[model samples]
Target: PEHFLITLALPAETEVVWVEDFYRGIGDCLDMFGGFLAGGETSGVPSGSAAVISIAATGSVQREHLILRSTARAGDALFVTGTLGGSIHGKHLDFTPRVEAAGWLVRNFKPSAMMDLSDGLGKDLPRLAKASGCGFSIDETAIPVTTGSTVAEAIGDGEDFELLFCLEESRADGLLQAWPFADLPLTRIGRMEEDGKEQALGGGWEHFRS
Candidate 1:
């Protein structure tokens, strides 16, 4: 209670690190906050031989980038884990992260790679491409923007709280057909290919460069 009160007195964007030793006894914390325990099965199936939860939190309003650009591949289909935009209106903080959904995808579909979308597509999509060693071509019309947000806001506005990922081209159709609305609205914005560098077809947002 004291720590909670202290935290309250700190600031709304304060970062708290509850566990310094990830291997110590953070299982309970992970379990409570969308984390699956290692050595235990997730979604009723064992996760090979190596599985564990790790986290790092700090005090500061920092932009988090999950899923990487190095793991994507040519002919891979791109996907967003949940609905896009409107985070400013309240959904970003209240909505659940797509950790479980990502676990399911890794275990079931075995995607080439995955990442959560924190910053808007403008920031994230490029990261995905950079991580996967490939470039992407996004169809602006197919992007899933929030109801009240404009296309630019949906693409550039941070705090959408979604996951943008890529899977083999072959599984794109099946993935959409199998789980249309698994948690948030999913969309096939584009496909991955070898383009030498990352560049958006329409345009994307940039923190330092635009």
Candidate 2:
């Protein structure tokens, strides 16, 4: 597994207003590079404590230590953060990270583990399985798609910049109500299981070698 680590140094106690816009730019960079660490630069003002966001991919394919398919707990509810698809339309380069949304989830839902689903669930779910040491059950129709894209295209396309996580089932409703990310098209697509089989229910982008 390889690591795509993004370190951001911003002024301490930064206003909530700018924090999001700041990471959105970073999300843009991630979206541009396919996975991450493809090589790039950072923007925005520099100050205060540096925030490091490490993103990884795990699976049969390896890029140092990025692939980390995690196991899902039986009572865990699956979650997707942010909007999906249509990223190619400046959304990729200008999309906002659900930092506030994620924080809300962490504080409210207490996720067992989390990962950003850049590549579609097709390529990402297996990676998550490897990390959590569990299998997943995907409700394909539950996945949200970008405007003008078909379900097939949305599921298979890469660079969605959405976050996928697992949490106890009982906390699902409260978490959803707390963030209101649903307006952003965030969706609950599935749940975690103790099983270890990797299932590629949706389709995603092809690997460079593939």
Q: Candidate 2 on 8-127: residue-level lDDT in tens?
A: 444556677776786686576556544555433444445655554444443233243232235356658888875566654656766665656655665565577677778876777677
Worst 10 residues of 1 by lDDT: 1-10
Q: Against the correct fold, how does model 1 do in TM-score?
A: 0.65
The C-alpha local distance difference test score for the whole of candidate 1 amounts to 0.64
Q: What would the per-residue lDDT of candidate 1 be over residues 145-164, giving only the tens digit for each residue?
A: 88887778778777766777
TM values, all candidates: 0.65, 0.62
Clashes of each: 12, 23
Alpha-carbon runs more than 4 Å astray in model 1 = 1-31, 34-69, 180-183, 201-210
Give residue 182's error in model 2 in angstroms. Answer: 6.6
Model 1 residue 52 distance off true place after TM-score fit, in angstroms: 29
